[model samples]
Target chain A: MGLAVILCLITWFVLVNSRKMAPLPVSPTSAMVLVPPPTLTPLPTPTIYVSPTPTQRPGLPPASGGIQVGGYVQITGTSGAGLRLRSGAGLEFDPKFLGMDSEVFEVKEGPVEANGITWWYLVAPYDESRSGWAASNYLQIVTTQP
Target chain B: MDIRPAEITANRANSIVTIQWNDGHRSAYPFGLLRAACPCASCRGGHENMSAEPDAEVFSTVLPESPATRIRSVEAAGSYAIIIEWEDGHHYGIYNWHYLRALCPCEECRSRFGEAV
Candidate 1:
């Protein structure tokens, strides 16, 4: 008799909890009103990046042909004859000065093509007036010793 | 080296000017380029702004088609330079051989000078 009473109470408790847990029925119109609207996201804009000429990197050895516009370079491959620095970028321009072998210079301008030769404008660090265009064949990048 | 022009010809039909240098190199300049590269003090902004080289900006500047860009005539100034007269009555630019050669608008010249057109 006591066991039968315990089983009946357990059944009663389950039925009561189930009724509380069950979801309430709703109409389609009510469901739509309760739901939030979908959101729209905009796309990101695209960007264009232009590569710089004579690109440089950190902690790396200078390029063999790194005679850049703002970098330093040394005269080479001219033997002892010296490289002729011209008033302009072409071979036709008058020679402004003669750059000796291994003389260091700062690149001021040029990569101008003339007479089928590549020319660069170099300026002596010691003398600004001693500047002119020299062939790229006789130039080498000057790298700092670490 | 002294550079001089062996010949200069204007093709109004093509709106191009050709200069054959004594060094055997030839430079072809557009009418607008010659006007934009005018070495006159006024065109250059001031007398102090005059330079042996053409301003690097001229290679990319595209002036509108007008009287300023039309070449009325090209005259030799002594033996060293040439004066260009424009249809707009502006004829003060004296382009020397050095300046003209430097102003060459070839792929080689533009690339070496770090400019674009």
Candidate 2:
């Protein structure tokens, strides 16, 4: 009976001590949690620009010479010196204005023989105020009116 | 006042026709103005429509560059009037001294004669 009481008491003390022990410490690699990176907003697409191309008129011959009444002409062959526009066909008439090189003008009246030169009356398109007679030497026909 | 032109000169270089009056006053008329104010019976639309003064519309009218507006010659009619021949071959306008004075576009004349004349 004394031997049985001793063994029972020892077992009870061991159970109490086992219950008081702390849990095991966690490892750093095993404790890590997988998280996704934050979602990003995308940038707008860039706009592309293209240059304009000149289109050729079909069946129309390129203008070279022969300015007619109601036709359009451009000042050329002046060596950038510009052409003189006079109030009258003759050189005796005062200069109305200086027509710049490559400037376009519409033929209003023309072919007046004066000062041994053929003169054509030219007027600015859409503006009759700027009109005068110009010699044919510097004028290139741009287009003839039908 | 009897206003008579002492001298009439067409400054084609400036496109202005100037008339020097006996009273020491000068009137400069634009080539366009004279063409627009052509006093010919046909230009006035009819003989009955003709008047001593320029029509009210002539002052404000802007005639385009044409043979009708191009002065070929200006001739005296007797001693009181003058005739202007346009390059277009229209020469019936007989501009008298009284009518020409009234047609002056100067500020002073416009104020004195009024724009309607």
Candidate 3:
């Protein structure tokens, strides 16, 4: 019985230790056989997000009963006008108007009533000229302040 | 830099402020709004903590006393900025280039403005 027990224990030890032993070596010919893994390494690529260009804000809206115009005083037609303050009230161009040709102008301080309707008096100056006032029905109001 | 006449032809759309460089390079700057904000020392210096005042009051107050404003031309300082000679003869401010470039009013900027662009 002891002898039988010794044999059984030897078998158990072999079975457990066998798995831990060195792996069986393959033949040279068998080793040459190629096998590829199922998974693949993917290449990395960069992604870029292109943004769009922005549009310019349109000139200010025309006041009621009048239109704003802009352009060089010497340039004919509305295209040359930067922001014109044309009035149906028969307003005439006066030297009192601060700006000359090629000058930027803005509406400052008024929508005062004249003759019976609200009018906008523009404060503008020549490129090199100091700020001054000009009369207009067409006021180009800037949406943003300076 | 090769200074040349600006290519401001009748066919070309006129911009609010057109800058032509000495090298014959031209850029159109819209005057209405600035995306990067004004680089007037007041806008840049105070808010960025680069200067003492949190506002630009000090710089503006000194404008009336500047001599550069006597000149009519805007002198380009570098690829980035210009020296604005105010009508009052001030030349104390240096407008940086990025500030001007960011002011482009193209369709992209407008859309952004409409939706926090």
Q: What is the lDDT of residue A137 in candidate 3?
A: 29
Instruction: Show model 1 residue runs off by greater than 4 Å.
Output: A1-146, B111-117
TM-score of chain A of each: 0.55, 0.56, 0.27
How close is each model in CA RMSD to the real structure? 25.1, 32.1, 18.7
Of 2 and 3, the candidate ahead on DockQ is 3
Please provide, for model 1 over A1-146, each residue's C-alpha lDDT reduced to its tens digit, 9 standing for 90 to 100.
99999999999999999988958876766745555777855422212111221132212225555566876555655544567899888888998767754455667787788999889888765457778899998875543221
Top TM-score prediction, candidate number: 2
Q: What is each predicted model's overall lDDT from 0 to 1? A: 0.68, 0.68, 0.35
Deviation of model 1 at A61, angstroms:
50
lDDT of 1 by residue, B1-117 (tens): 566787787645434567777776666665677898999999999989998888876654555446787677777777778888888999999998889888875434444444432
Q: Residue-wise lDDT of candidate 2 within B33-68, one digit each (tens)?
A: 788888889889998999888875666555554667
Quote the positional error of residue B94 for candidate 3 in Å: 2.1
How big an interface RMSD has model 2? 26.3
In the range A73-107, model 2's lDDT, one tens digit per residue, is 65655543457899999999998777654345678
Error of 2 at B79 (Å): 0.2
Error of 3 at A111 (Å): 18
Q: Kindly report the interface RMSD of candidate 3, rounded to 1 decimal.
A: 18.4
